[model samples]
Target: MKTASIAHRVVDFLRRWPPFQYFDDDELFSLVSAGRVVFHERDELVFMQGRQRKPYVYVIQQGAVRLEEQSEDGVDQLRDVRGEGDLLGIGRYLGFGEHVYTARTETDVILYALPAEAFWETVKRHARASRFLATYFSVAILPPALEMREERSEELRLGRRPVDWMSRPVEQPSRPLTCLPDTAARDVARLLAERDAAAAVVIDGQGAPRGVVTPRTLSDEVASGRQPPDTPAQALMRPVCAVAAPGLEAGDYLTRMLDQQTEHLVLTANGRLDGPFAGVITRRDLTRVEGAAPLALIEDMARAPRISELAALRVQAEGVLAAGLTDPDATRWLAPMAGAFNAAVLRRVVMLVEGALADQGLASPNLDHCWVFFGSAARNELFTRHDLDCGLIYDDPDPGHARGARAYFLELGRRVSAALAACGFVTSAKAISAGHPSACRSVGEWEVAFADWIHQPIESCVYRATSRFDLRPVHGDCRLVERLERHIHGEEDRNPRFVPLLLEDSMANLPPLTFFRGLVVDDEGGYREVLDLLRATLQPVVDIARALALDSGRQAPTTLDRLLVLQPEDDESSLLIEETAAAFRNALYHRARTGLTTGTDGSRVDPAKLTRLEQNLLKSGFRTVLRLMEYTGRRYGLTPRR
Candidate 1:
């Protein structure tokens, strides 16, 4: 064939798929000219598992290929089937030198093999084309990407040379000197000197961090004779510079300090400044880590000057999470750390939204308000596939001002929500976000809303409460959230019908188990015959923990923490609690591992992928979920509704 004719045929095929479709005609033709056609017979091996990869990527022009993995018993199990337009040899393109899965032609096939170098050159030249390919790669070829990552994790775990910028285990430094906001500055200084600390955290009555007093502030206030030593610490301290959460690496604190240009960062138990104070990280801690920190991405997101920069920083945050998945302890920390990063992103989005609203000549909301997060984000159990479930709660607006104030907050919600989506948070399908008017309400409105839901106790109301009751303040004035929390706990305590309805709702989804079939799979959903680990396993535990915690007048955010705080009524219950806790941990570990490996929320598991021990542990976990449901039923004098 003539060179031009051959290139024309290749371009014709390339234009039919994404990424190439994003390229201009001239770019497409140029991209195709560097490629050549290759042919494979039916059943011929295109690439072998464990073989070093070639420096070329293949796009099928005709026919199909099967990706398979060989088991220890020497049996080939089909992993995926790819047809025309599907890219192959991506393992090599992604820098995984050895093919993890063997690709074999399912029929006589024609493929265009493009050199990796040329493809990357094109990707570099076309920004939109690169984005198109990235979206395609994340959605379609993520499994292989995950496999490559897991291989790197294994290398690290085996004590191979460490990746640059090693993450040191997060430590809880000795408790910093603390005082009430009303404490005299002289007393604060004495305590700081007595504790041998450079700063003191000034907290409110509830132990929520309000501000910080550093040596410089002390010197400026007292030593300069600008104010009497009797001045309250609240008047002298600066707003808390930044808050670090547990499990954050030393590098994370360092990055926060560098980004804020502050010498000190407070450590909070759950990453919320309003949560319990744990410790502090100072400038001295930065010396422990020798390279650029991944947490720098979060800092970058916070300081991002534009929406585009914020969006790009989020991608970097995801990369950080992906890299951290290799370390087991780091993996444990990934969800919470991701939550902290997300909170910072959301705050930036809010600031931008407020600024945009101001530019539009819209008046700011005329009430104190808060941004509340629900579901996994609220519980600090966020993972890759989680979406935004948030709402707005403002102080009661004057009746005459209600309409305008509501409209302003609603628009703010919509703008911030859209920004969050751009930053990689999936929008909730249920419309249970700040963007929804029903979810954006005043504090009094929320109180009345909870009361109405409790009094009604309808199925839908209970269902909504199951998620809503897990709310936590993510940004804005958190006092509104504290008020909302007080209202929920009070309603739970006063209403006799609320706990039973909640119990019934929690028990509605029973864990799957059948003696003959073993672990039951969801047959009706997209995950047909695959175990719905999130629904059947983790959620039941989560639901039961929420119910029990509420019943005990406690509001622990996470399932594990809630389970730990429960006071079992009997030895049997205690044993179940301990066993159930262990099982829950196992299930969580498995989900995290699977999600990290597959680049999705690890909510589903194929039994075949689990070893015998893991399978047994999962079975036990489900059984414990079932038992907890029954216990709730009996404790509440409730019967399963037909």
Candidate 2:
């Protein structure tokens, strides 16, 4: 009778906490039945650091526990403290195999020890419980030690309700309309029509998706006389992309769709091309997920009939940015989505300008071209409005037609640049813009210019040309952008001096830390004593990644992606790389959050306004920046110029 009473008390306490609150009565009772209550006196050690992980995780039934880690010099450092219903060991041993810190009682304490395996099993079976835990423990899964304070500003919470829903795993994927690779196009079309689906997946003999056929494919193939209705499904199909069904979240799926520029994504057992086909996520399915407002806004921007409408939509994007930063899971995917919003606006602006030009009897020059964005825009790292840094690249024209082609492109560039400026992305005189004659060029000219910059390796050329290396095509012939990429790589391969010089250049901007290793702020101008977030912290990481990427032949456009691509295998080196990536992400988030609050470019920040925790994070990040810069210098056998 006493044992039963103790179990009942433990179950009542567990029920009050989340994850447990999500469990039903039977599951809750079962979980509590297998758990035991333990007590410790003040200062008693609960678990020792570096010991094998225990099979159980503890819930604080009473009192408190503090987690401590011994530094290399044998000093104990407090990592965290847990009290009341707080859970312990979730982050430290998610898969770590050993306790990362020592847990000691802060007072006489009572803990309900739950079996880890049984708890995880319950979490997996209950989606809400799983998601709650996923968000609560995301720090382990993502870059660590970035504990930013949650924003409580009214502006940030405006659209917070919808994001809660968006973060859920995509509603169970719809049963995909499927066809064999050898199935006839007519049969595929019939399947799509009969199901009222817009697309059909072509599967292999093992049920893996090989291709997809959409209404567009049918129209372009059979209806346009390019092929008969009896043509094989494979012949009418396009290469398909699949995401694993397990652990798939709606917001993540939407981001994948935006990134891949696909209207549909096939679901598979393992999220690989060869994995067994499961189902599909289409545009309509995304619309059903309320968290897809950002995507819907982008689509609306694309079809917006006028620049005024696009400008209005641009204003709404700020709300999206604010809401994303306020949410934990959405924050991880914020950069890509912001970039999508920016690109969508730019594409819309270009289309509007082109249409206006046509009305004025100014048809674009008959040449293949691409409008490319530089720096953050190219890297898809944009969070808010930035000064437009762009250039135009087109196919080489006939000798006599060169001047005409350049003139036409320049006119288009000027108008588009002006349109973007009106739409909130102003063009700074110091930054590169497509309207500038030097940046508006044909393919051959662009090739020659890039080669000169590479072979020259002069400070002036490198300084002016750094942005060019980060270029990504936002519109037009992507092949032109690829040709430029190949040209740049080929030049680097031939000119070994180029990457080294670039590395040295990257090191020129020392981390903005004082002699005492504190954040350095501007001493003069309207923004005196304010830290330039971009220059002091963000740019060093960007520069290091760019130089390292070029040297390693990594062509990924973003700093984070570049870092991942070039990450070393050595444990020590890997930790430094990981820290550097985390620093960059933290700084970027801080800058964006600051920008949203201050209504500036997010470049300058007043450290005094930051929470103590945020200030500490910045200091830690700056230190990591210093370490990364030193690592880069050592790698290149060069020193930062005094």
Candidate 3:
């Protein structure tokens, strides 16, 4: 059978649609030919309820296909409609028995009928296509994305959420075994054996968690044989470090643990640690949150009505992520959450902004404009910061062609920028706003400008590349966005001038801390009276990771995730690299929390507020980040250019 010009258009349209977007042109045409086109009169049954549909899928070509449902509860409802190129009979092709919804032609219609064997054969060969059909077949599967979400929710309710990857308070520690500060090692050792326990909590006179003495700790001390066997248990005990309110997420658990610098967390009913130790949360608990975070957020995004609601919801999703950044396992959990939410938000932004722009005369003749997100968003790195880096690409650069489109793009950016601002992040002050001429350009102009940036590799050019690496289409033609990326990779993937210079810029991260001595802060110095958020942590890790990734042709959107993909396995160095990054995130979270608590933007951590154990952990983690930054600089030969 010969495919029509209309069939080719169907192919083109299907290729643009998702799941189908994953298929190539040749394969698409074959799919069109295997499918038969039929016309239906008004109010006729396209496929009856309980009908056995074996060899066809339908796409509403010229009119609409309405699916009416007769519920078991004795109510009739219009389930959904398939209009225009919307694919239908997916359940018929994919479902096993009787159809759940009855399909009827709403108006005079031309519908394409795809052969079941051919469609299934094509889908079976492609996993995304299989999932694509499976996903859209019903509203149910689309909600949580998987069964794992309910399990995660249950875990969160049980206080075993993502933060627990850093720690899990004992499900039930046997009846309290406490020892006085002055208890002997011999007595403590004997008591441990008698109680059939490896450790015992050491409390002050007031019965507060002062420290803990474990067999490993005790044995290590005993190995020295310096202290008498009768030495006080407190003498060998590690001081209490991180403490949190009971029933927190695993991510929070890991973060607080990382911040306080201890694996053992003292849990309290309230924030105050005056009560008995509720339990301990070890780093083993973060794993559950990873599988759960992405699913939970996706479900929540589906339920959320307004963008404002989603903004807060997105913020809530970060609770575990903040914690995951502390423990080694936490980042793993954070990665998928970051990627999924980032993708979800980008998708929703396109829908919302497109609707808003349509109201403002965008696409008056089916718009040729594309709204793109660059920098972190494009590359799948979504931080809480307002990274308002975006651009608009239209089909023509002949100023007159985009006059209405330009105004639409400006209004589009303003609305999106405002939406993002209301959602927590502060927008950019400079004209990176889509309304600005510098950011919004016609497709030809954008291409020319991009080419110039790639070739020049100047200071301004460096900034552009650094900021624009993550350019993704939030709205309009994503093919246009992909083309832009291909052009970038082809031109600047390993450009010596650009890569080397990026390395140099990244090298100017936090100053290496003294190994023997600690970092010093001068009275009026940048680090003075505050934890240098930029220098004390995140900047060094992010900047160096980005540089290393770019230099190595990894071409990632962000620092941490790129590093993970680049070196998925853990060795001495990669472990150090990962842990160092976690430390940076830990510091940032701590600063943010501190700032939030004190109602001050300055992330001031009072050394006195932290227990000795926490101070030590913070010091060790901070030092690790500093060392990693220096190591990357040395490894990459990032010498200061004269």
lDDT of all predictions = 0.70, 0.76, 0.58
Off-target runs (Cα >4 Å) in candidate 1 are 1-236, 239-280, 283-295, 326-332, 514-528, 593-601, 611-613, 638-642
Give the Å error, residue 248, model 3.
25
In the range 1-642, model 2's lDDT, one tens digit per residue, is 697888888888878767687698888778888888889999999889989877888898899787777999999855555567767767543567788889999899999998877887787676545544544332225323222343343322323543555567667544668888889888888887889996888888898888889988998889898998899999888987446564577777777776655667778888787898888887788777664677678778889998888999999988877876763234567778878888888888988998898999986679999999888888877776766578899999999988888889999999988898888875566777888988899989998888889988684477777878899888899999999899999998999988888878877765543211122422110123567778767988898899889889867878888998996858767878877777677778777877677676788877656533354446556657777877877887988642
Candidate 1 lands at a TM-score of 0.60
Per-model TM-score versus the true fold: 0.60, 0.69, 0.47
RMSD of 3: 28.6
Question: On residues 281-398, what C-alpha lDDT tens digit does candidate 1 reach at each position?
Answer: 7654554554435446655766788888987877676666666554333433455656666676777888888988889888885578998878777776765545667889999988
Q: Is candidate 1 or candidate 2 better by TM-score?
A: 2
What's the lDDT for residue 304 in model 1?
A: 87
Model 3 per-residue lDDT tens digits across residues 1-642: 444877887787676554567576777788887776799999998887777765777767687676777878966555445566566666644335677678888789988787866766676566555544543432222223222221121111211234433234324343546689899998888887887664577888776777878777777787578778989988888877546776765555644443343435666556566776665554333333343344456556655678888787767755644544443334444543455555555456656766766777566434576777665455444444445466777766355655776666666666666766666655555325565677777666776776677677674455545666556675567677767767766666646566556666755544322111122332122223334555555555666666566556665555666666666343667667666655655554455445334534323455445432233335556556655755665665665321
lDDT of 2 at 334: 78
TM-score preference between candidates 1 and 3, better one: 1
